[model samples]
Target chain A: MHPINRRDFLKVASFGGLVFASGLSGCASRAAKSEADEFYFVQLSDTHWGFQGAPNPDAKVTLPKAVAAVNALDPQPDFIVFTGDLTHTTDDPAERRRRLAEFKKIISELKVKDVRLMPGEHDASLDRGEAYKEFFGETHYSFDHKGVHFIALDNVSDPAARIGEEQLAWLKADLAKQAADARIVVLTHRPLFPLFPQWDWATKDGEQAIELLMPHRNVTVFYGHIHQEHHFKTAHIEHHSAKSLIFPLPAPGSQPKRAPIAWDPAQPYRGLGFREVEAEHDEYKLTEYPVVKA
Target chain B: MKRRTLLLGALAAAMGSARAEPEVIRIVARKFVFEPAEITLRVGVPVILELTAPEVAMGFDAPGLKLNTEIPPGKPVRLAFTPDRPGEFEFVCDVFCGSGHEDMGGVVKVLP
Candidate 1:
């Protein structure tokens, strides 16, 4: 693992020549930058700890590598957020517990101050996330840090993808406290929009959640579950889905069915990667890093 | 009277044949959703449900009728079963496809 300093962190953070709505380099130039000036966070999703298959022969190996990659990040991130699917699908109660426990034990190796987790259908929908919550606490909640409001929602907790009237009301009440101009980031397992109903990629009642968020001026959503990198612009909100730590799925409707792409021995961990987001007040820049260095 | 008895026998045999032959319904499962999301059939009649996915591998699971099968992309799997009662049986894609795996399901309505 390459040890990263603040300089090395900024060098990689400004990747791809991607520009934000505002200038982030200027924030980086300041010697004593305030917390709101610049901060970075890492997103790791779809680890699928218990997944054992041809698509990912070393599925377990990639996770520790991901943790080490984050730990090696220069300046380190404020925290690490795992989008969802900590474990593969399982119905047996004991197996479910075992998988969750194993996933927790493995992810605990991350050298970060805090690690936030959500749930994918594989982790939660079967038992309505009871097993997941028992390990990770509330599947959906909110917090504030460095003038940014972060909301974690559990759309997969219910197999039907219904957020329920209760959670919606809670969200409304939560948002009402924040000013309209507050920087907000929403996280979930599935795409909140109806990206493709046939594949279960959409939240059953996500429009309601979107409607509540529409009022916010600065809001971005980072989600996982699609197991690929995708960007969408809807109603002044930017939705980004990160790549999986395990395997990648076919593009939506690109094939007759949705299945994990077979792994290539020549290019191991080809589509498996994670994302780093650098936030500065109202602006945020994102860069995806593959588990295997190019 | 003999002619009337023959006529009655022929009518009963025709009905029996109709009951024995189930209607065929073809369903396609793709990313996140199923084509022909809802299907309706009559009770006491057998059905040949032809399930196929043109893209990747998927599965059809209707526990109510004890019907479950893996559907390979572009390969059709025919399931033959008779509806013994009238009700709606929900069938889900038992196989994981992607993020939308959970939403890949529809209702099989058995009508009286």
Candidate 2:
């Protein structure tokens, strides 16, 4: 198992060159500030809402905890992004709907301007993400915040783990709309580059998407599914994977089986956490906070 | 002599059917598609499908045959079954992958 590495700089940015001034010592109060200087957003992934039992006896509670945490942020994030895996997957369409609906209700408690959602395989795979799209929106899409372009691609919806030709074309066209120096952030459930094929950590055709973004010097990716914080770089693009809310998985290839690590009754939700990124100028700062039993 | 020769021919044919081994099919599932989307086999012949997913988790479901199994990343799952009759069966990736998950499918043709 490779240990987590914290080296180099973790930077966040918005279209307006927003940089979060809050460092490891987070803000204690939401003070009125210079809006032009920086902006921040929260990323909560792998909530696994409908999850029940062994791996997370309190699976239902963690998601609400995350929401409450976000709401309590001294300076509320401009928006919130739930990367994927909103609920546990089941073949029954009815069960899937119930889980999705319940998750929506829970997250509604957050106070944010906008909430961008994408599906992890668990929420999309069975019905080809129909439920997810119906509940959320397009599986792959993009929008601009301030001056940065954020593209959310649906790598989990494809069983083969590709972005598909149609989506790829869309991406090419989308990138063409922006300047070469435009700061771009990609959001998806699976890692865009092949992290570890054997563990579904990599997207099958993510390299093509990366190639399209290769021309752009400022590109960053935030994804979930690995259930742990990992940082990787391909070419000039930087990729970061977030921790899951339900349970954590072992490091890549650490165990013969890649199942979720059993919930530590003592630690409760130690390694399971969420991320907050603040962007200023060209520098992005990311901090991860784990869920603790209330 | 003619009768003995005819009897031996029939025995050889019977032995051939008895000793036939099951055909093996290796299936790999990626994001939106499965490799070798079409599989062909003879009716009444036992076949084994070895399934693997290079990334993520997927499921192969053929409701007609009551078959459903998960394809985990970097793991091999073996399934054994025989085509009962000559016909075409469609199997789809039951696991939710991404936008193309529904399109991830293959056809199995069993010949008489």
lDDT tens per residue, model 1, A105-192: 8878887969989998788876888989899899999997676789998887765566888899999999999877677899888898
Model 2 lDDT per residue over A233-270, tens place:
77667788888999998888697456788888887886
Model 1 TM-score (2 dp): 0.70
Candidate 1 colliding pairs, count: 14
Cα TM-score of candidate 2: 0.70
Whole-model Cα lDDT per candidate?
Answer: 0.80, 0.78
True contacts kept of 2: 0.25
State TM-scores per candidate: 0.70, 0.70
Candidate 1, residues B1-112: lDDT per residue as tens digits? 9999999999999989867666789999997788999999988777899988998777787767778777888899999988898898777785566556655788889899
* DockQ values, each candidate: 0.06, 0.13
Highest-lDDT candidate: 1
Q: Per-residue alpha-carbon lDDT of model 2 for B1-112, expressed as tens digits?
A: 9999999999999999888878789999887788988888888778999999998788787654556687888999999998888877667775566445545777788899
